[model samples]
Target chain A: MNIPADLKYTKKHEWARVEGDLVYVGITEYAQNSLGDIVFVELPSVGDIITSGEAFGVVESVKAASDIYSSLSGIVKEVNNELIDHPERINQNPYDSWMMAIEPSKASELEVLLDASAYEKLCLEEA
Target chain B: MKKTPLYQAHYDMGGKIIDFGGWALPVQYSGVLDEHNHVRNKAGLFDVSHMGEIMVRGTEASLYIQRLITNDISQIKDNQIVYTPMCYCDGGVVDDLLVYKFNDKKYLLVVNAANTEKDYLWMQENLKEEAEIQNISDEFAQIAIQGPKSETILQKLTRCQLEKLSFYSFQNNVNLDGIKALVSRTGYTGEDGFEIYVSPTEALELWRKLLEAGKKEEIVPAGLGARDILRFEAGLPLYGQEISQDISPLEARLGSFVKFDKGEFNGKEALLKQREQGVVRKLVGIEMIHRGIPRYNYRVQFNNKDIGFITTGNHSPALGKDIGLALIAREYAQIGNKIEVIIREKKSEAIIIQLPFLQKKYKK
Candidate 1:
């Protein structure tokens, strides 16, 4: 529910923080809350090519496991290794817990995402 | 819509409300794992008032129950409880319920929340003319205080000597802060606990009092989400998933609870025949050998042939891996057998293994 204004969101409930050519990717608060307490996070491997809308990893909770979709097309440059042991960090701070960093194939792909307000409205409509 | 007495408390505690079997209730609060671990290591409170309580009283109550149930009532003593499955004529389980004998003429049947109305109607239609039946779910609220610290916390609030009550035993008319309650040493989670049945109006006060007494242990308010994971970890069978009207008790591997040797019940003949002839299909545990999580209705493939389907599927919080219960052909249900779970179009390899992936700690 906490949609920060500067971030962009995907219909799949992933969020991207554009920092020039480097984009930080993680599941949104809505996704984290929906998934419940994250017990395990399967981070995308570094240097793996990720396609937009394609599932690259999995986020596991006690009750269910959800596929983590890539919001943008890119090659994974880094991942939050901290989440391997303490996946609950995503539940605590979804915005702060970046799952992976992708070096963009085309920075313009970010344009396809919904802004904070539009994403919030989309979530409301889905509910 | 059906509402529990603690609906307001659930809303106040930030519960994600959902409609389950016409009852609007909390699916999760805080988070599932947080509440789950709380109950495992510390303590957690659950509002299970949505569960049905049916009272059978009269001289013929015992005889009526004996005929309706598969378990032998003669084996259960007064103040004792037995968990058994009520079945249809074909040996398919209608529901798994707990039968508690309060006294010579009094008995309580605790059934799943979703099947309350259906179960009540079934009893009414099948009972002999001398029996009296009453659906008392609305009249009472049931609260479960489960965990290692559950007994000590509950003991502080009630006058009854909690130590005297052994597992599956109950004490009636126990005074709890002036209100009368029935405290039973029984719980779904494989833990030391008590399930209290009290007047709906007194539920909030009892919840508050227990919370106050369990303050040192940080007793959390758990929802159905935590309850599911806890029960799964304990390898307990869930009604809709592991057991259903289409699934027989023999197929579900719940033979221990099915008294085939006992006197005639609805499903006695079929179950006995199945037992004598040998069962063809059985429910078994499957752990993922690949990356994907197996889910319900997923096809279980072995040797390129469809053998079974997953019943209950989830990532085990305690095991840190994907696990599920599958009803597979008897030939494919052996331990260490290789199988494939079709998770979303792609097939993932899984290993046929024994259940309770994480060993249960029943708080001995």
Candidate 2:
């Protein structure tokens, strides 16, 4: 699993890149690999709000559908409309394919997110 | 979880194992969509050893089968197979299985893996003095080579005149290189293929050998995930979803398989009454008009009223669209009827289309 050291991740397999008060979020490589051949990705609207640890959308594969959770509480600033037509892009390159951009409501919550090392350890333990 | 005889082979192939109805089995190998397309264009081998097998023998075997299943087993000759549904007294499906007749006094039943014990017990309860039933699942293993290229690929393994074997027919003890096995021209995938049954001991060897023999044909090892999608696109009935304890053959749109003219059988009285009165619900196909995909057990609405629920839904790799099977009120079961599928609390647009999603390429 490729966990970019520069970004932050969550135990739920979501990753966030912090830039000022704006955070670009997407499912991690581990999440995309676990979900093979992603057929559809349902994402929240551009201005929708999502609380930390709450399910904001779904990512469906050939086998089953799974909920994608938000890492930090925020109002969505941008939604990756590209995923609606080409969800397989996430499987091809998860880290680069950000799903949403959020304006953090609780900016301090980003600190609570797991670092790459911690997230990798959590994935190993779960596996 | 229970393990099939070929479990180790699946592990070695880097299969993604999942607990399927208490059995530890591979849900995918390369991937579901990849394997699915492989089976459609080339060929794919599947380890179906987890499926249950039961032997029925004695002079009353033929007589007993007439009362046990909805299809007429007598229509099939020796070395032939018949697909049928076993039902409860209330006309609900107990299970759907393939019955292979070796002779008038002997038969083999291939049932769903999870329903083995329950089906065996049900058989015993209905068994007669001369008829006997035995759960021989652990004693045997099964594998299928399915796709358009399956016949040519499998022909290289066995000297049997496979070209002479018609669909739904089997030959017992055909030597595949050296392994003594029963090869049948039957499969779940809508493709011209063969299902091979052999002793559990030879399972892994046979699996490896078949994969090796079909290497040139691009036959990949498929798992439950791809198999499910293949069968779904073929318009086959799944036990729990399409038909179950509360769903009858009629409601499931498998009424043609129920042979009321063949004489009394399990669920005959109730089914006959149901036939006379007409089914209140009917199973139909749905194609999404909205962006979202519908899923299993999702609510279906007609005129904003909860009319039914989706049995199974998936993105058809072939058709490149979202399709599903739904059992709903008969009044709303007509083709071209528009409906709403509740996907994550939001209503999505869908329309009833002709079943099967696409033309089946079975015989070719």
Query: Which stretches of model 1 miss by more than 4 angstroms?
Result: A1-6, A19-22, A40-58, A67-89, A96-109, A116-127
Best by TM-score: 2
List, residue by residue over B1-364, the lDDT tens digit for candidate 2: 9888999999999999999999899999998999999999999999888889999999989989889999999888999999999999999988999999999999999999989999999999998749888898988899999999998988888899898999999999999989999999999888889999999999899999989999999999999999888888888989999999999999998888999999889999999999999998999999999987778899999889999999999999989999999999999999999999999888999999998876777662
lDDT score for residue B191 of model 2: 82
By lDDT, who's the top model here?
A: 2
What are the C-alpha RMSDs, in order, of all predicted structures?
2.7, 1.2
Please write out the lDDT profile of model 2 over residues A1-127, one tens digit for every residue.
7889999998889999987868999998889889898999999998898898898889999988999988788799988889899999999989888999999988679779999899999999987
Clashes of 1: 0
lDDT, residue B187, model 1: 91
DockQ of 2: 0.88
- RMSD of candidate 1 to the truth, in angstroms, is 2.7
Candidate 2 regions exceeding 4 Å error are none
Individual DockQ of the candidates?
A: 0.54, 0.88
- What's model 1's overall lDDT? 0.86
Per-residue lDDT over B228-313 for candidate 1, one digit per residue giving the tens place of the 0 to 100 score? 87887677899988889888888887888887667778899888889988888899998999866677788999878999899878
